[model samples]
Target: MIERTVKYKKPSPKPEKNRDVRLPRLYKSLYDQIINNHYKNALKTVNKLQRLDTDNEELIKTRIFILLQLDQFSHASSLIQSSSQPFAYEHAYTNYRLKNEHLASQSISPDSDDRKWKILSAQLLYRQGDYKSAIDLYESLMSDLSPDTDEYTDLETNLKASKECLDFHRHGYLQAMDELNVPPLDVLENNPAPFPDNYKPPAIDTSSVTVSSATTETPSKLLKQKEKRRAAMHSKHANKNMQIDPERWLPMKERSYYRKPRQQMSINHKRR
Candidate 1:
């Protein structure tokens, strides 16, 4: 019997892919640990995991999400921005930058995507003079709201507002045209009033009227008395006239005293 050298062959080492495939399960366990508020353990596990699976996507995503939960936005932003797989938050954040339909002050424009990315890249179509596009975009977005309507982007609602705004502007224009088409208040401009050819004012008859420089004679006694009466009547009317009421009187004795007549003049002739 030839003693065939039974060289014990060691099975080839398992492939890197097979080793990498195991990392996610352990990574997820570590994630759960952190999720349970096991910060120290989670950190320790993540450190061990990083050494074990240097570039695992789940590990990275979890790390960044944890950092974000810790309110470390800047660091989270950095990590997420540098992720290998595309992150929804990155997309959401890009939208945050570019502004969604909502126009929140804090949002910025992000990179573009397929039909979404308002926060990052989509602009108000109407603002860009693309009303039809804006309307279409809004309508399309509305159709997707069976479950998550509350999560509608600022962009979608803005598009709706833009549509309403467009209608309002159109209404204003129509009103303006209607006003223009209506007849003017006064159509006749600068037209002189008509004067008939036969129109004539009555002729004045002043043949007996004469202007005089001096009085011809002194008035008779009765005429002078009438003239004095007329003068007195005119003086009575010359004061600012107002209605007098009996109720306005202070008292009977006071009124009688106020109404006392003036004393009559007594003339004395000299008996020389």
Candidate 2:
């Protein structure tokens, strides 16, 4: 048996690492756009990044964030749904923005440590007329948040608003208004008068009224009116003739009104 030499084939370099070389540059551009509040441009960059790395969870999150910044809650919600990674806070927030209270409440993780989730929960409670719960959440947030920050200030305002809403709902002010038979300001503004839909205005009886001879126009009065109209026409024609100027239709600069003193006819021409 003759021994045959077996040649080994060299392995080719993987192109996967080379293809990712542009990813960092794209990421930097995306971050720059986001930082400058250019969400529309950031969204475009995010799309390009997604195409390059379809399975990147961070890219999906970034794209969803950009969509939210652009107020595209529907698109963000759909993206969240299609994504395998769970975006509990984003999903809840998108549902909240969309006014889907049930979905928002269901998706929100109340026990999460994220402050934004708590704020969203409080807002949802307030929307649901649970002002007491909202107030409690806002108070807790106020205690934890630093007083110097804008978030703390906003929370303070929300807490006060929640307290006011709670007081309005719990107090007898609405009952008093109802007892007094007074409509709310919104009702008064929207419908100033509660006229019946089927009600019709009374018809005027013109047949019963007669035109008196004194109010009727006589032949002499008709002649006088004709004379006045003739006089008006004559006066109008006279005024038109008097005001007529040959240069009236000319360009402003070429008109007599704009003529130079030296360009105007001299005293000899005027005399002629």
Candidate 3:
């Protein structure tokens, strides 16, 4: 019997396990940090994540958000500006925080339908003293939001403030004063007299007028009398004792002179 050479096929090597196991752990760490409002720690974790996943656009945005949370608006703005992708809202928000209204307005698109973008736009309008536009935007947002939510409460407050500002601009006391040509006290004092230069006042006769005794007294005499009266008043009240509670209006616990009684400490011993 001719022995047929049975060539055993080489077994395929087991598929290599993924070597980069730190990616998932880093992601979890970053998420936990962000959730706990630990932006400083989150920033470090995000840097690691960015290194591991260099192509992730979301990671870049997350870093910008972390910077914002840390109140590093300048850094966030620079990062956004340097990024290849457009982050209009984030860029605008950073500019807004930096008080660069012109740059913020230019960066934000007017036609964008994003709610946050709209809210930022409204805030920009409010800052620009465009109360009517801000009020309209706030009112529209309020209608869409439930009253129980915090966002709705904030919108309501903003709406009220904007309405008050609008009213003040349209018919406020200051505006009324301006319309009536009421000069400020300082301006009135500085300007020429309201009467014409040619006008003159009639002379009055002083011989018939009778002066009061108090008015006729010399200033030195008057001052001496006042000092004498003050001395007598002080002497009258000098011996009076303070009988009423000095802190009568204050609560018992809030009184500075009041102290809480100390409790006696008792130790319990256990028998072995």
Candidate 4:
């Protein structure tokens, strides 16, 4: 019988999937840092994660959020601008914060799933003083968005603020001043006639106009007569302000006034 050489086939080694195990732990660290408001630390870890998976959408978004939290608005804007594909929310939001409204509107893709883009767009309109457009958008969003959510709260706040602004624009400062029973700002802005023609302020009796004794004197007067008297008290008592102790004030010889020299101890004295 011819002995057939049985070639032993070595088992194929397991695929190098250990990298997958580290993914969640790394993400957890990122999450923890963010939740604890360790934005700078979170940003460092996020950069590391992005390096491992350069195309990670979530990592990119988190990095943008971290930059925003750290108040690095320009950096966030640059990162969005450098993206290979448009991330509508990030791009629009960063541009919005940068006050680049036109660019933000351009960056907003109509097909984007993020409703935040629409919210940002509406907020841009609100900020640009376009209240009607903003209110319409916000009202529509309010209908669809739940009131308990932050987005809804923001929408409601912006809507209310926009309405107020709208009212102000409609009625104007003069009308508002009249409604609130306050003087109009224009009255302060315009130069008053030095004196009305042939009209003079009535002469007042200076002797009868007494200076107010209260601390709430008009700013034109630095100090009333009573205030001057009170302020002068400090200078008046300056000599008496010294902290001389009564017991220590007794007369003594000049030499006794100084501390006595420490007595020299006799180190070699025999016990007596």
Per-candidate count of clashing residue pairs (backbone under 3 Å): 18, 0, 0, 0
On lDDT, the stronger of 2 and 3 is 3
**C-alpha lDDT of all candidate models, in order:** 0.61, 0.87, 0.88, 0.78
Q: What C-alpha RMSD separates each model from the true structure?
A: 30.9, 18.2, 21.6, 16.5
The runs of at least 3 residues in candidate 2 whose Cα sits more than 4 Å from the true structure, single-residue gaps closed, are 1-21, 182-272
Which one is best on lDDT? 3
Model 4, TM vs. native: 0.53
> Would you estimate the TM-scores of all the predictions?
0.31, 0.60, 0.58, 0.53
How far off is model 2, as Cα RMSD? 18.2
lDDT of 3: 0.88
Per-residue CA lDDT of candidate 3, range 1-272, in tens? 98879988999998854538878888989889999999999999988788778989999999999999999998998899899988878988988999999999998888888899889999999999999999999988888888999999988888998998988888777866768967689988999878888889998999998888998889999999999988877666565575777889999989999766544222222221
Local distance difference test, candidate 4: 0.78
lDDT of 1 by residue, 101-131 (tens): 3542234333445554552233445555566
> How much lDDT does candidate 2 score?
0.87
Best by TM-score: 2
lDDT of 2 by residue, 73-92 (tens): 99999999998888888998
